[model samples]
Target: MNIWVTSWVAADDGVRLWTATTGAPGASWPVVLVHGGPGLWDYLGPVAQLLDGNRVVHRFDQRGCGRSDPSDDQRVARAVADLECLRRHFGHERWAVIGHSFGATLALAYAWTHPERVASLVPLGSTGLGDWRTPARAEHARRASAQQRARLAELSGRERRSAEEEREFRTLAWFTDHADRERAWAWAAQDAAAPHAINWTANRRLAREVDSWPEETVRARCRRITAPATVVHGAGDPRPAATAAALAAALPHGRFVPIPDAGHHPWREQPSVLRALLLRAIRRA
Candidate 1:
């Protein structure tokens, strides 16, 4: 199959955007894969696997991540709006929405706001799009934060941190590429060496800008989205299963599938299964 890869910075939310496209040009039915971080890098590997050489896809580093410049917490809404610019930039009237983790929240929020432009929705390892401040999600946040500090100290030759500072460091550690400790730790070092403000600002951005889902009250309002929707979760995900189930059930045409032995990062844990399921979703769309 023919394929193309290109990077360009487009204007988004008053910031210059760094975006990349892979696969053949003019893929009639495009799937836009959103990476899970309110501040995470948009990953391309799993999406590449899921595409399986048969279809083309779009993957990019989201704002404040990778090659893109960082902005304030106010950039969240504007980041969501960037989806429209993405679709229109490629001239797709409607596109398939695939979001993982934090991206899943953005995907649901986007579908909720612009149902007319989404032909399909797939949210994996999702945080329920409801008021996302429940105890369970908070725990997931805490767990991810803990891993960050341990990895950070391991990377830099720094002395161990006090328990309290360890807790504080983890809060700012967003979703990191952890396929390998060497690679993951390199990412940790980048954060460690940066002037305290850049990293701390991201944490401040998370606290100041993120919003919770009105899960209980908000689902009733949007019934027009009849898209082929699939919500997949890791059976052993630290995040709550009930919330994932509730989210899938709430969608007018949602299908819920849970992967056994998988954790929050199911794509890495069960790539074969995830790839198969995602391919099926795309074809169905």
Candidate 2:
């Protein structure tokens, strides 16, 4: 499908966001996809195909990521502001938000702050609610091979790293199953390796802010979100499934669903299942 690409100043700070619209342009239900990696570019191009026929899908690179303009301010609040700016630019009063990984955390923040602007919320492979690093580390240790573990340990002990090294560490830390790991590497090679494809500086800064975020505050915000919410998690993901369940239960209108055997990138590992869940969420929304 042909995606309509455009660039707009999606923030008051003059950061231009590269955005694409796919699916039925006239669809009443407009859904915005927040890609994983607070820094991961808008690589949800393939995933757009699944929702394009029925719903209008919007995807954009967050500030300093992908095709978006570079900026020193990588705060989570800035990211939320960018989303609001996008909504206003699209003239949508309210829309459904589907976020993956760290993007899910952003989506939740936006929903909590502007519940009146969200029709529904779908958080996929979300983290940031608690001390996710502990469980993630445990899972990595359990799943990584001897070589992978050694490499991870070496990277973890480093006080600093180059962009490529950071990407490599993330690939190992995020994906457990061999196929998923391979796919992640391929994705990084194709998309993230390009010049200005990823803003590592911004990623590092924003990630620290996300990690420092208080779980109690996030849970408190989730409880106040009035919009319907669904937490979709891959069973094979490093983050514990209990976290997703608790997040869903915390929301006033929330449900949790886990996809068996799927890893972090469910779109690659289990496209059909993930697509089905997205459709269900949209229908209910």
Best by lDDT: 2
RMSD of 2: 2.8
Q: Write the per-residue lDDT of candidate 1 for residues 47-101, one digit (tens) a residue.
A: 6655636555777766666666666543556767877777778788888888888
Model 2 lDDT tens row, 1-285:
656666555587788988988877665579999987767687777778877876788999888887888888888888999999999998888899999888898999899989999998999888635466789777767776899889978997888879988777666655563236546556534543445444667779888887776777777888879888989988888887787888898888999999987877777778899888888887676
Tell me the number of clashing residue pairs for each predicted model: 6, 1
Q: What is the overall TM-score of model 1 with all chains considered together?
A: 0.73
Candidate 1 residues lying further than 4 Å off, grouped into runs, are 1-3, 12-14, 25-28, 73-75, 129-213, 221-224
lDDT of 1 at 91: 82
Whole-model lDDT, candidate 1? 0.65
| Candidate 1 backbone clash number | 6
